[model samples]
Target: MPAEKISSLDDPRVYKFTLQKDKELARDQEIIVDSPKVVLRMMDAGRTPKAILANQKFLDDHGQRFEGMDCQVYWADVPLLEKIVGHRLHHGVIALAERPESLKLSALGHRLLVLNGVNKAENVGTIVRTCDALGVDSLLVDERTLSPFIRRAIRVSMGSIFRIKVRTSADLFSDLQTLRTSGYQVLGTGIAPDTHRFDKIDFAKKCALIIGSEGFGMDSALVGLCDAVIKIPMRDHVDSLNASVAAGILLQRLGAI
Candidate 1:
C-alpha cells in the first residue's frame, strides 16, 4: 500500500504507534521498535512489521523499502509525529512488530546459556549480542527474568536481538535435567573455592552455562542441579564481574559456536 500521510493527532489508524510501557506491549506479545535499522534487521530475520510510522522526509529519502511489504506505512511531519509517539522526535522511523515465536529446548543447539532470574535489561541485551558474536547457539531464560523483547533490551542488543534464538522455560530445573540426561554438562557460575576454574576443565561439547541473578547468585537448588560449577579466576580484590562481561569471556573460551 502507498504511504498514508498522517495529518492529525486524532487519526485512529496511527494509534498503535502511540507509546505504551514496554511491559504492557509484551503482555500482548507485541513490541515497538525504534529506527529503520532495527526494523530492517527484524525483517531480515524473516519477520514482518504490523505497521511503520516514519517522518515524511525519512520516507522520501528511503521510501523503496516500504514499496511492497505487507504493512501500513504512514508518514507525518516532525511536530505531529512527536505528539503521536508521546516523545521527542528523533530516529526517522519506528515499527510495531510481534515478538518472534519462542523456540523449544529440543530445537536449540548444544551450546546454550541459561539465565536464572537475571533482572537487568542491559545485561540481558549485552549477553545476547555477545552470544550472537561468539556463536553461542541459543538462550534459555526462566520466566522470572525480564523479557528480552523489552524495548530497552532491544536497543542495547543492536539488532542482534533479531538474530538470536531464545526459549523461555517454565520449569527451569526440569528442563536442565532433561538437558543433562541428553549428554549435556550443566555448568553453574559461582564463587565457591571448590568450584572448577573456567580454564581448568575441558569444556563439554554440549554445555549449558547458567547465570543467576546479579544481586543474588544461583540459589541452592540450581547449584545442586548442575553437573559442575565453574568460576572465573580473578584477583581477590575484584569479587565479581558484570554478568555480560563474564558471559563473553566464558563463551569465547568455550568456543562452542
Candidate 2:
C-alpha cells in the first residue's frame, strides 16, 4: 500500500503568505482571511505549548494549499496579544477563513428565525448555534442587533455561527412586511394573554419566528405586524427564558412539527 499523503501548513503549496498586523493576527486571524486559511500563533496569557504544537502538527497534515500562499505564524506574550486584540480569551489557537455567505430571505427553503434588538453577542451566537441544530433555514438580524461574527459570539457558538446563514436588515419592520408578502407567516414571541401556545402553531408552513431583547419583549409595532404571537408555556416563577434559550426551545418545537 502507498503511504497516504498528509497535508501540512509548512508545505508552500498549503498556504498563501501575506503580511497582517500583529494585532489583527491574534484577535481572529482565521476568520479574517478571504480563503480557506488557518492562522496559528502563540498567545501571551496562559500560553498552552501543547495545544500550539498540536495545532501545528494538524495544520501540517491536513491544511489545503492556503490559497497557494504561506501560513503565517506569529509570537506574542499574553499581555501584548490581549492588549492588541482588546480581549483576553484566545485559547492559544485562532484561524480566519472564508465564511459561507449569508442566505437571502427569498432564497430560504423553510422556516426562519429573526432577531431584533438582541444586542448581546453571546446570545446572538447561541441563537445561531440553535438555528443550525434545529435545521432552521436562515437567520435575520435586525440592524439594532449584535454582530454574530464577533470573536466572543463565535467562541460561545463553538463556530456554529459560521455554519448558519445570517442576514442583516436596516429596517426590520419593512423586512417583515416583505416576508409577509412572500407568504411567510411571521410569528412573534411574547407573553401577552392573546399569544398562542408555541405547540399549537403549525411549523410546517413557511414561517419566521421573531425574538426580541431580554430587557424588552418584541416592539409593539413589530408584534402587530406578525401573523401571530406565540409563547412557550412555563412553570414555577419563570416568566420567560433568556432570548437564546427561548429561541432554542422555539426552534426545537418548530423542528419537531
lDDT for each residue of candidate 1 in 96-215, tens digit (9 for 90 to 100): 888777898898788888888888999998988888888886899999878888877887887788888889999999999999889898899988889999888777889899988877
Best by lDDT: 1
Task: Quote model 1's TM-score.
Answer: 0.93
* Residue 26 C-alpha lDDT in model 2: 40
Compose the digit string of candidate 2's lDDT tens values, residues 1-257. Answer: 11123233343322221223323434433333211122221111111211121134334553342323433433244454334334452443344443344556677655788888998978987887788778885788887787676555666665566556677788889989988888888899999778899888776477888999999988888977887899999985889899998998899976654
| TM-scores of the candidates in the order shown | 0.93, 0.70
Residue 104's lDDT in candidate 1: 85
Q: How high is the lDDT of residue 55 in model 1? A: 93
Per-residue error (Å), model 2, residue 72: 4.0
